[model samples]
Target chain A: MKVEQILHMIGGVGGNSYANNSKLQEKAILKTKPMVEEAISDICNTIHTNNIVVADLGCSSGPNTLLVLSHISNAIEKHYCQYNRKQPEIQYFFNDLPSNDFNSIFQLLMLYEEQLRENKAADYVNLYAVGLPGSFYGRLFPTKTVHFFHSSYSLMWLTQVPQGLDEKNCAQLNKGNIYIADASSSIVYHLYLNQFKKDFSKFLRSRSKELIFGGKMVLSFLGRKNSPAFGDIFNFWSLLADALNSMISEGLVEEAKVNTFNLPFYAPLMEEVKSIIEMEGSFHVGQTQTFESNWDPFDDSTDNFVINSTLSGQNVAKYIRAVLEPLLISHFGDDIIEDLFSRYAQNIARHISIEKAKIVVLILVLKLKE
Target chain B: MKVEQILHMIGGVGGNSYANNSKLQEKAILKTKPMVEEAISDICNTIHTNNIVVADLGCSSGPNTLLVLSHISNAIEKHYCQYNRKQPEIQYFFNDLPSNDFNSIFQLLMLYEEQLRENKAADYVNLYAVGLPGSFYGRLFPTKTVHFFHSSYSLMWLTQVPQGLDEKNCAQLNKGNIYIADASSSIVYHLYLNQFKKDFSKFLRSRSKELIFGGKMVLSFLGRKNSPAFGDIFNFWSLLADALNSMISEGLVEEAKVNTFNLPFYAPLMEEVKSIIEMEGSFHVGQTQTFESNWDPFDDSTDNFVINSTLSGQNVAKYIRAVLEPLLISHFGDDIIEDLFSRYAQNIARHISIEKAKIVVLILVLKLKE
Candidate 1:
């Protein structure tokens, strides 16, 4: 089964996939704050209403789920208060996959609301929050109900692994690699691109319906620039391939297995994103800004991602493992995941020590076409 | 709006309701395990199905929520292994109000599942857990789907604070007190009794429909026994009333406010429970046992509740405040909650210092009536 079906299924209950190693994701939330506040500030100036609905699409369960809500609320409140306008009732719709850790989100939401209510010293802040558990690849709300939509580091996920990589379609099409590596065939690249086009178009199509006219969405996620350097998307996947290659060499896993497996992921370049938005014809897309974050998950530094000489590749490996292990385990089995990630971390650290490694995130603020 | 409607409203999010003060509730969970396991053991033997669905109704968001599920799972596993039978897949449904911190439960659920899977040494477990967010007083699951049921320390909440004590009906039906106090009239007692009867009967009716034939349920909740000499429901409410009396004398709060206010709580008498079970006729009611706990929320001693000589009534008052402060604040205002609970604690300390105080909890194991 693909990700949509097997979500929280194999990792079942204990899988540390998202809940355990969410530090990098937390950093992603932090890095995107300016873009988020910028979008909110613009919306506050233009979108005048007594009721404001803010949706955090693909808002996976964790400390980060409620972070964006508070930021948006504060920004909106700040703008209204500065102008001496009555603050509208803010309704926060925290949307995530049904498998996302919503229980934790709800628990934290209460605690957050408690803190907000106390700080505001109001009987009620007129803030309402609810969990909409479903896939963001499809529609999730009453049409035109949502005003502000925010997502970070989630658009990289394709609805499913590219259509043809398994034995069901071919014999290890992307040989000795689970995702795009430097050695991958032209066919693999094209297949992934086609899948990305389909998924991104569907994503745009779905979101376009839910957001109100002129509503703003800040979309930031892992993507590629043309330069496939050691620190970019190309290197990240290549390093992971490097880890799997060691496993294959050690005979821990069949080379055939790695060849057959493919990640349900695709990193779009800025040009590709522009083409899709132009091709889709739904959004007045704003200028896309490229952001560079550290491969080191531990690096909470909002400053430039300077790879400290002491920092090992394991930090990046841990971050990748936290997000990707579940899918890997689903394909390669649990026996290989720990060793694969450990070796992967070492490989990444070795490479990055020689060269600065970074992940490129593409941030775009889209306004629904009036 | 009643307790069910306003929930965290008047008390505001800053208010420390049962959801906030879960350590004591965790203590309640700890104090009532043998009974829980006993019921589980009996069900494991009697209910022979390939699948077992266990539902924890009123499973408030806290550290203790996932505890009960683990205890039930381990006990079932133990029972089946002892009999040389294959263990069935257990589906756990964590049910609570939409407002309950379900996020904590879900987050903890994964951690718990991870621990269980590790302990069992199984690559994958047959267990499935899902959050069922709704009220337990109504239909929650597929009819006749749930096999075993458990609820702890939550049934005391009468769906709405016994009707007619509000301004809409009249001025202070139960004069000079909030709950059933020594100063309360006969009508006040009867109103609470009738409300409890209705709510409990509805609870049984709802569960009876959901549970399979011969399915068993273990319910442990706050109640009162006839031996109301020193420590019982009698003094707990009276102590709270004493605090309010002191407040009235201080002129900090209007006596009319105290007279008009009432708690959305009812401590069922053992006889009252027995009669309700017999009257409902849905379950073959088993022997009902009464357990007493110290007014001090910290006391987990199963041995007779020995009130510490130095323990002031404030100890008990604090415990009550932690659980009931939200409801009281809703009836009164935020300004009085802190001061009201402070005086309540002092009054309770003074009263209980002269006399011992304890809380009575009634435990019952019910079998679906054939």
Candidate 2:
């Protein structure tokens, strides 16, 4: 299935829904607040227009959806207040795949507006929020219209699965693997790397055209600290593939389905991400950083001790399920979802108890070329 | 409950959904095509910018949601081609209540874009569709940003049900009626009229700030043909109230609930609409017309004979239920919806079999004054 058509965070406000289980993403937004504030300051200093257009690309439905926008607007408001200048109007575009739950985002906005009204400080800014539904791989705005763009935890999702992993095209390209797992051929690694290069380059090109001169973007997404294509990020998916393999042994899921089902995702090395941006040639790379979060998002302890690995396993499983369940259901059918995730949780519990596991996240700030 | 919080057309693609039952609204859109086309031409001739910002206020989700935008863009494209001018990019903002099914509209937009790609003529036009979820009774767009605005069958929905029609505020004001029925006192009639005036004036004032000088708006909504406090439009709500009263007699619904329940809607006289625009002093009325459609939207016969009263009644009931079910459920509860609409169908059938009922629709073209 086309990733844009099928991929979305679990919608609505249920236990497994993205709205409820999105603290990991919320943490990412919070972690990047300084970068976001810096970007806003740059925009305010450079752009002279009365209306500032900002977009949150891949803004899945959740509390985190507006968290970034609120940061940017508040920063802009503070900057104008510091200068004793009339603040410009802020027009925010919340963008995601067409399948994303924008209705929930709009609902959150009503409460946000109420909160803003109660705060007299926010009166200096006139905020307009619009939901934009489209893939970031293509153009979404008029040329030179957007002033700032922010996307979080979304770019790792490639436009589609690497072109030639299917059994019909090339047999055993990545057998018994849903991603670039350890057992797969070296060719599987290159296939994913190439896809990420193409998709990320396309994303940069599209945003470059949409952003005005010196327009800024702050993007944070899943990435890898290790130089190799198969990094610690693979372990997260490896456990999932293992769970699927166990189900296949019991004849609960078809082996062919497992063999063909690959995630349209690639956690790029930070070097790979920078190289793609440079290759795209339309953006000037700015501040870039990489950090690690534990596999269990709820486990914030700095120590390596695996305290309650079972609970951590379930927490990790829940976070992944909130993001990946829709894509999994599309390919494997939902009947396998409950059984597969439960097995995946057990596999995660077994592995993390022996060794501490963490996933790498990368942040980048870029500006449009003159 | 506030109308903005609870009011929305029935969502999703089901039998009772607004998407499925919006042929009535679609007909109104098609009926107002010439005026919409004229408004587009006026915008093209007057505005010099390369980007045309068009907004459809109260753009409820359905096939009809984009129908008016499509007409406006096609007209703009044709206008540019005839003049040998490069087509400017068209930015469409679909505004509705926060509870609107924006996800469905976004899904339809995907297909719409695919269709545009297939159409060779559309290649010259850059189309951007954004969902703006809010009420039109307030400012949605920035000052002097919107070039054209179109709203069909939506303006009649008042911002709220008139205040003080309740038993607590005033006893027996509009006793036993949810609207200005024939038996409603003159005080009740004035209450509805005064609310419509306040809401419509607020709507005009808000749009005036948003629309650029010479910006155009084409609005079509339910209106009154007869010059009286009680008109044919009253018959529509009176029948619905009759249905509720019957349920009250059967103890299926509470009498206090029916007494308090009032539609956040008004069917104004054409003169009342004109007076509001003139009083608001921002928009100059251009072209105005009135037309009628059968209460049974399926009945296209101009001679006004009920071909199948039962079938026509059911169709009418479905159309109304699609638009009003959420509001009804919010106040009275969902348990009474099916029974209420079914009983409403029988009441409509009995009345229309003898009288051949029709509802008045008013169309107005307004241009923003400098």
Candidate 3:
């Protein structure tokens, strides 16, 4: 599938206006500053060079990407000043699906132009930012040409959901709900694993070919402790799907249209990701840390909502739609989609306490082999 | 308590004699021969001496102990034969509660005397089998004296049925069969763990002190993957207990006394056992394996009446006196004990299948430190 179509199916920025809003973007950028600082320090130590090339995969149009890039720029400038040396040149690549709002990213760059110019260190820091629209899995840059690569909350999106859902054995039948049956579930999981392996191995192989002997890569993404079975979050989703299916069965909406759509992502476990990297053997692992974020604003404390929403607000509406749409229709009827949305909002208001939604993020820093 | 009194409370080896009888003993010995061979080989490779001191803890009365001792004797003989060296000077200690039928064990020893003579390995193997009359927790042998230690199907029995009956708890209120109340259950479990820790730690300290460097110890016992509430099991037993209590309330039998009763034993999980050993740091781990045994006889092609009768026959009578007597007197009047026993036996004969009583056994081998 084309990257744009997949992004649309997964309801990223272009599909969810609330998620695409600038307020949320600013919040995410602020939250990501610390991480960017750490990644820059590590990369600088590894390269021992004033110059750096960094790319943020899935850098959807928003203030967050620029904010992170700015931190990297500042770190490099600080290093140059401390060493009494000229600032190193920086080439920044902002990557995302082709459908992402590059216009917004461009506008954000212009908004920061004055601040970039005012910092006299900016003279030492030659910053170049470009939008690279493509799947991060395949070659987005020249082999070994990049110094640091980072992605957050993006790798989890599967290329496509498995097919043949209506057929028996294609789906698990439980109390009023249908799940991707075991056979299909395993098939989908392995398919994702294979794709990840192939893409990541290629990325590493390309890095090995292009990167200088001591380049480093840092990546962060959503992950789980164990493999995602059909029963877990999907079970909740399946309940929603069943609710939608019931709506169709009762003549509430178009069945063919619903069946045509599928979720475009997969959230793999941290161990699985580690295994893939280790098995490929392209980079030496430097460090890994997994942390959770509290996202829902309804029931969460104001501070947690403010912090986590900055990181996750844009994705929340899409996540609910992907997971709960089917169940809403199946149980509450498609006619009530708007009502369900309101109900969802109400539920969030009632129970969305800070730290209620747990998001496990695994960050891995690797040193490129010479 | 005196071993005899303890034995009386354990149904006097009448109901579940497979745990204590000769035919079963022979099978266990035969089944375990390969493992014994491997253990002996490993031991011999590490220690060059032709002399060894072995103790079998929880050695029940009868031919089982004899059969195991013989296997040990044979392993030593084979080791020497292959090496073209003198047979090991072996000292075998058969240990059990004092109430165990020492007479039966003595008879089995007599039966093996002629066999040992015919092999002419008897002179080389100085077998000194002794009955340990108290708990195995305290020091049972001299320091720096033992070479090998083994125990099977003995660790599961708690030192005593958890005290504090009549205390209010969920398990008690529900009167769940075979399960104790929640608090009482966990309290009992912790009690057992504490006791096991103290006793096993002492046993290990004493054993480590007594055993020569490179001594081997193998222990096998029943264990669980997850600890269940006492109420679950107590609820089951309580039903039976209540039935008996009802009989007493109805004045059909004299007040039933349950003093000195002991719970059937099972070992903790392999991890638990390993942790205990590791904490002591007295010995290094060699190997660990878990094996499951078929306990229910109904599924067996052969009639297990002889075995079952030996193990449960005595318990059968006590069960009636404790539970059925009271239940029958209160519900069915005075003369129902005999009638109920017949009915109970018939029901067991019809429904007691071998698959129902499967037990898991974990075996661990440890080597004494130099």
Candidate 4:
């Protein structure tokens, strides 16, 4: 099936079922809380409508979806409160793939609404919410319907595995690996780069049409600071590739299958993102900043509940598995998953003990100048 | 895991996975289309608000959820056009269990909204929808927020199975069956009756608090004709019981397990319904109707698409399975399900061939006196 479909099935958390392990996502959101508030204020300043329409593209439902809503609602209310102006009603659009756990989101919304009422904050802002399920690569809303949007850890997903890199289309050019690495063929790298360009441009074009002229969107996703080829970003994938490569000799996985399986993801640099927006989108970048984060956000001793074991590598592996398992399972069969990830965790622990992998996330606030 | 949790996990159907098997629900909804239209007309005629807040309690996701929305939107708009009144914006709240497939609902809603825009009907209705995920027997919205409510083929499900009827509570009060039947003891019948009274009354109390004084609610659910004692209401469950009883002989399932596993449902008569409404609910019944549908809506050749396989019994079994499978799978191990259902189809076929089994659905339009 499609990746969107797969994401929905495996998405959520520590729960045994379909929960996506989203704790790391929670940490990223916390770090970007101030940016979220700024974006809300920016939109409130520009939009003069009786109702504010806010869309959180690629919003996975659960505690985080509600958390985003609460923040948006509070910031907008505060904007009005500061000026002694009545806050406009809010129309929250939570956009996710068609397979998202909207049930959890909706239920969580009800609880959040109750919390607001209890806190006497509900009357300050009339809020309504709905889930919009579709890909952000194309138009999902009517023209001028959305005024503000927020997406984090989502835009990095390319439209699909780059077309020519698939085994069906070409000879697994990126042999014995599933993602970009220093050793991958130049053609493999180009295909991935071209896919990112096409997908990001399409995303920009679609959002430009959906958002009003003065609308604002704040996005934070995995990115490379100085350049898109930073090795730290790929080290996690590199170890996973090594684990898969080890299995190849044991006949656990086909080398051709590994070569064809490129992740539909790209971590763009700040400059690359800025250029893309200028050329492809109707918006101008108001601000761009990169945050350097430890590859394991929960590595802190205080929050060891997530990764109870002493082995930080296994903890990181579990976190990554929660995300990449569905994608890997689709490309390779289920039988190889256990051994592959075990090997990956061992390799990562060996490396992390020496030097922890680091990731630089680029956060951008954009304004619709046109 | 709890059945409710399990239901949330395994619900939904189709290529993407986790999609609800709602084909039978579609057929029942189609049959009730005119009734829905009538209810919508009645509500629109009496209520006037800046924005009409409507709640469809027990609204299942998929094509039917959209179908209900379309009918509701059309009826409200038609009312305004006929009276030359300014059409109020519509805020739709689709309420269902937390386990419902709201992802499908959201995706389908996006498509429906597009079709509306394409037809230029979007301007007529400033429609907004949000999912309300909770049991309808409790408060789901703010006080006076909702002006009207609609429910169909729901409410028959009791809030929870009767308290003392469980195997642990009593001696499997209604053994050899999953519901009330002639074979069941008077204690079993009374337990179901009391439970329905409690659940329906709680439902009314919750909704009363949520809606304005003049707010109206329309409900249609499985019911029997003349009186609650009519065996036709229980006949379906009886056949299912027989299928399980057969399994006891073959050692496929535990007899006590089937005995203790009564479905959390009740189908009442018009007289019984009125008595409860008068005693418990604050609203007065404006109109009462009973639709006598074949136990199999597809019994007629014209509507055979729903059950194409020439066996009416099998068709009914499938319909029931789509709805009750999650619940059954939770209670009885999945091993005996297929065999049990196959036997159920065989037994039901025998009964239907002799005289097509029938169901009486009671639809009531209720209004709260100011």
Candidate whose lDDT is highest? 2
Greater-TM-score candidate between 2 and 4: 2
Considering the two chains of model 2, state its CAPRI-style docking category: medium
User: In model 1, what is the error at residue A161, expressed in angstroms?
Assistant: 0.9
Which run of 10 residues does model 3 chain A get worst, by summed lDDT?
Answer: A3-12
TM-score of chain A of each: 0.91, 0.97, 0.73, 0.91
Which residue window of length 10 is worst by lDDT in model 2 chain A? A116-125
lDDT for A198 (candidate 4): 90
Q: Comparing 1 and 4 by TM-score, which wins?
A: 4
Model 4: residue B143 alpha-carbon error in angstroms: 9.8
Candidate 4's TM-score reads: 0.69
Instruction: Score each candidate by Cα lDDT.
Output: 0.72, 0.88, 0.53, 0.74
Off by over 4 Å in 2: A121-125, B121-125
Please compute DockQ, using alpha carbons, for every candidate against the native two-chain complex: 0.06, 0.75, 0.00, 0.21
Model 4 deviation from the true structure expressed as Cα RMSD, one decimal place:
7.4
- Lowest summed lDDT across 10 adjacent residues in model 3 chain B is found at B2-11
Native contacts present in each candidate (fraction)? 0.10, 0.77, 0.00, 0.34
Task: Report candidate 2's fraction of native contacts.
Answer: 0.77
lDDT of 3 by residue, B319-351 (tens): 434322322343345665564454344333333
**Order the candidates by DockQ, highest first — what do you get?**
2, 4, 1, 3
What tens digits encode model 2's per-residue C-alpha lDDT throughout A1-370? Answer: 5888999999999999998888888878999999999888888888788888999999999888878878988898898888888878888999999999999999999999878878866433399999999999988998889999999999999998898874445647887889988788788889889988999998998888889887899999998887665667888899999999999999999988888888899999888988888888998889988888888888889899899999988988998899999999988889999999899999999999999898888999999766
How much is the lDDT of residue A353 in candidate 2?
Answer: 97
For all predicted structures, in order, the TM-scores are: 0.56, 0.98, 0.41, 0.69
Predicted candidate 1 versus true structure: per-residue lDDT over B1-370, tens digit per residue:
5455445311112335444455556666776678777887887777787678788888876556778887888888888889999877776777676556555555556567668768776644556565665557765655576788989888888788676665545555677766777666777778888888988999999899778886788888988776322236767777678778788898888887777777778887788888998999998877567777667666666554345634544455555666665566666777877787777767666665665567778888898877
